[model samples]
Each structure stands twice: as structure tokens, then as C-alpha cells.
Target: MSQITTTCPWVTNDPLYQQYHNKVWGRPVYDDRELFAKLCLDGQQAGLSWLTILKRQANYEELFFDFNPQEIALMTQDDVERLLLDTRIIRNRAKINSIIGNAKAYLAYSQNGANSFSQLLWSFVGGQPVINHFNVMAEVPAQTPESQAMSKALKKLGFNFVGPTICYAFMQAVGMVNDHLTSCPCYLESSAKK
Candidate 1:
């Protein structure tokens, strides 16, 4: 078997993290449903660790109707109440509400002749990954001008929980920006895909 190197400590030895790091992280996602999933997950991660949400991703998919924006937009208050009591995922009402609201906004954006939200978002970086060659994980930025602009635009479009920091995280999650550390083998691999 070939050996692979990674710079993120959390993914250094963990198989799940390694899988996500190599396969999904920094890979531009174009599908609307997947984009919505990343947005919802990132927002839910406001005060929590990524690993926690990652562990519950299956539950999220099951309960959140596979992150279909149209379905999520139609979810009712009763759905929120039921999700609150479910231990499978984060139980924050505000976060849950944000997902529903974002779905509505996303559906509207898709319906109004604009490109899908994912396309509009990827356009900020010219439909490519912004590869950063950071030697250490700490060198990775929490926010960038791109994220700031994205946050402002999302707010203008009536979305919530999309602060600059959260926007940056969303960018990372959806592969709008390639934040993989230089030492990680997948960093170069992901960049070359652009």
C-alpha cells in the first residue's frame, strides 16, 4: 500500500477524517443539494467542532431529508420540534431554523433566473479552488476577503448565520477554497484537479 501524508492533525491518523480530507475537502461542489448540505452543516458547526458534526452526518441526512432544499424549505414547525428531541444531530432551534430559512433563500435564488447558489459562490474564485500553501494548520486563515464578500452577499439575499467566519468555513467545506496544508499529499492532488 502507498503511504499518504496529511497536515491536519485531526486527520493525520483517523480514517474517517482522512477519507473526508482526501476525497471531499477542497473539491469544488456544484450540485445544489450538496451545496445546501454544506451550508447547513457549516452553520450548525458555529460553536461545535467539525468532527462532531461529521460523526452525525448520517443522522443529519436521514432526518434532514437528504438536504434537498425544496423539501427543507417546506419543513414545518412540527418538523423542528421533532428534530429538537432527536439526539442524532445538533438540537439547537436557531440552527435548525437557519437551515430552513437558508433553504427558502436557496430555492428562491434558483428560481429567479440566477445561477444556482453554488455557481454564484464558485464564481467568486472563478470556478476554481484558491489553493493556499500553508506549512501548518494554524497558518490556515479563518476568514478572507472572498469570505467577507460572500457573507455580505448572502446577507443581502436574506440569509442568516452567514458571518465572515462561517462563510469561510462554508467555502472550505464546499471546496470554494482549497485550505489543505502543504505537507498533506492531498493538497497538491486537490489543487491539480483545478
Candidate 2:
């Protein structure tokens, strides 16, 4: 007999998604570049499922110079055109451009001496993960006040694809808020982190 493991309902049996759920999802991430990459990747999931973006993340990293905002900020229309033909990614022009635009925006945003990109994002959550205690997936909100505020601030700074819904999802992905169900094993561990 196999020991059955319980995970958040959103997790499917697919190995990759399982791996992401078991390891990456709802885990706090404080690295500036990693946060940028995850935010961009979440943006790419705007009109699609996260599994789609997750599948292509490696390709996105390879093509986008490891999500270095400085390098991506320099990408031009020619690069966009080149990427459009690549099947490894979503191949949506607007989505692709948003990543580049976000890179430029992020570069500008981070250039401020007072706050790093990580600091700016973490500030929205009071510099710690907002651990929730929902018992089911239905209780998870699609958007929250914090996410709305984050969306407004990010857009004000010239970022694209950062609607409240997207910001909330980004918040969840980066562990700015822990959305794991209370019964899920990940919940306790994720909520335990500072």
C-alpha cells in the first residue's frame, strides 16, 4: 500500500505540477531577480493556466537572459519578433512585450536608492508572508486590497499586465501571501516561515 499524500486541491497528479506544488508554491522568495522572474511568469499566465507557463519557464529564462532586468530592458522589437516564432513559449506578442516592458520598468523602479525591487514588493505585505487559514480552495480570494494596491503601484511605475488578479496570483506565487489550505501539509510549513 502506498502512503497517500494530501496537497492543495489545485495540484494535479502531473509530476511537474506536483513538484511545483510540493516544493515551490507558497514558499517565500526574497531574491530580487527571482521575484522579478516569478512576477513576469505570473503575468505570462494571464490568459492561460499556470501549468502552461510553468512548462515553459526554463525556455523563458534561457531566452530572456535569466530574467536579468537590465538585459531584458534592452530587448527590442526584433527580439520580440524572434521570440514569437519560438514554440517553447506562449508566443503572444503582447505578453512577450509586457515582459520586456516590465524589465525596463523594474530597472527604473530598482534604480531608486531607498528600496530594492524586493523591498518594494515585500513592503506591500508588511515584509512578511500573510498566512491564511482557509480550509478549502473556494475560500481563496481572487483579489484583495493589498493586491489591488500592488497593481496600482506597479502600473503607476509603468509595468504592464499587473492587474489586481495578476498581482494576487503573483503574491501567492512568491509567498507574499500563503494560500495553502489549512489541511494541506504545505500550509503549516509555509506559514511557519517568517
Candidate 3:
């Protein structure tokens, strides 16, 4: 018989989603570029499922110059119009523009001090993951005080589509907070890191 897998119930049986859940989601990401990319992808998930954004991630990378903030920051209205027509990625004009706008904001934010974008974000959690032991999916929250503060801060910096809910999802996705159920094998591993 197939080995029974224990993980967050949100994970579907699809190979792509499974891979993301088992290997990538809730895994701490310290790289600045990777963090920026994740933030933008989470923004794209505003009105859709995370799986939908994940499926088109490669296309996003290709079309958005591998999510290079410097390059994307330079994208103009013409580029937005063109990208809105591309079927490979989400065709929402506002969503597309938000990515570009966020890049510019990220670049500016990164210039503040010794900290990179990753450092700035992780600092909110005191440079470590806040591990929570939820027993079920219902216990998982859509937003938290930290996420609310993060959303406000990001908005102050000119980033869009970064409401509390989206910020919470970003936090979970980047492993800034471990929302994995206690019984899940990944929980122990995730909660251990600083």
C-alpha cells in the first residue's frame, strides 16, 4: 500500500501542489530575490488559488525577466499592455502592474540599511520563525497581528495587494511562521530553525 502521508490538509494530491507543499512551502527562504518573487506571486494569488499561481510561475519568471527587480521596475505601460495579452501568465492588468510597482518598492526598501529585503521582512519575526501548533485546518488563521503590521508597513512603502490576509500567506509561504499542524512531519523540522 502507498505510505500514508501526513501534512497540512490544504495540500492537494496533484504532483505540482504536492511538490510545493512537501518541499517548498513553509521552508525558510532567506534569499532576497526569492523573497521578492514569492511576495509578487502571493500578490498574484489575490483572487485565485495558490496552485493557479504556482502553475504559471515558470511563465512569470520567463516573462518578468526571472523576477529581476531592476528589470521589472523598468517595465512601462506598453509592457503591461503586452503582458496583459500573454496567455501564459495571469492577464489582469492591475495584477501585472502591481508586480512591477512592487519591484520598484522593493528596490527602494532594500537600500535602507545593511539588511536586504529578506532581512527586513524576517526582522518582523525577530529573525526567526514563529512556530504555531495548530491541530486542524480550522485552527489556521487567515490573518494575524504580525501580518496586519506587515501589510501596513508594506503599504506605506508603496507595495500593493499586500493586505493582512496576503501578508499572512506570504509569512507562511516563506517560513517566517510555521502554521503546519503538529502531527505533520514537516512541523518538527520547520519549528526547529531560528
Q: What is the C-alpha lDDT of each candidate?
A: 0.83, 0.91, 0.90
User: What would the per-residue lDDT of candidate 1 be over residues 1-194, giving only the tens digit for each residue?
Assistant: 12566566656456776777777877878877788788888888898888788889999888888998888999999999999999999999999999999889888888899787768888777878888878887788899999999889988887888899999998987778878777778777878886
- Candidate 2 collision pairs: none
lDDT of 2 by residue, 21-134 (tens): 877888999999999999999999998999989999999999999998999999999999999999999999999999999999998888876598888899999999998889
The Cα error of candidate 1 at residue 89, in Å, is: 0.7
TM-score-wise, the better of 1 and 3 is 3
Worst 10-residue lDDT window, candidate 2: 1-10
Among the numbered candidates, top lDDT falls to 2
Of 1 and 2, the candidate ahead on lDDT is 2
Which residue pairs overlap in candidate 1's backbone?
A: none
Task: Report the CA-based lDDT of candidate 2 relative to the real structure.
Answer: 0.91
Q: What tens-digit string does per-residue lDDT give for candidate 3 at 1-194?
A: 12336478898888888778767778899999999999999999998999999999999999999999999999999999999889999999889999999999998988777577887788888889898989999999999998999999899999999999999999999999998898888888778766
Model 1 misses residue 139 by how many Å?
A: 2.1
Lowest summed-lDDT stretch of 10 residues in model 1? Answer: 1-10
Displacement of residue 129 (Cα, Å) in model 3 is 0.4
Candidate 3: where is the Cα deviation over 4 Å?
A: 1-4
How does model 3 score by TM-score? 0.95
Q: Rank by TM-score, descending? A: 2, 3, 1
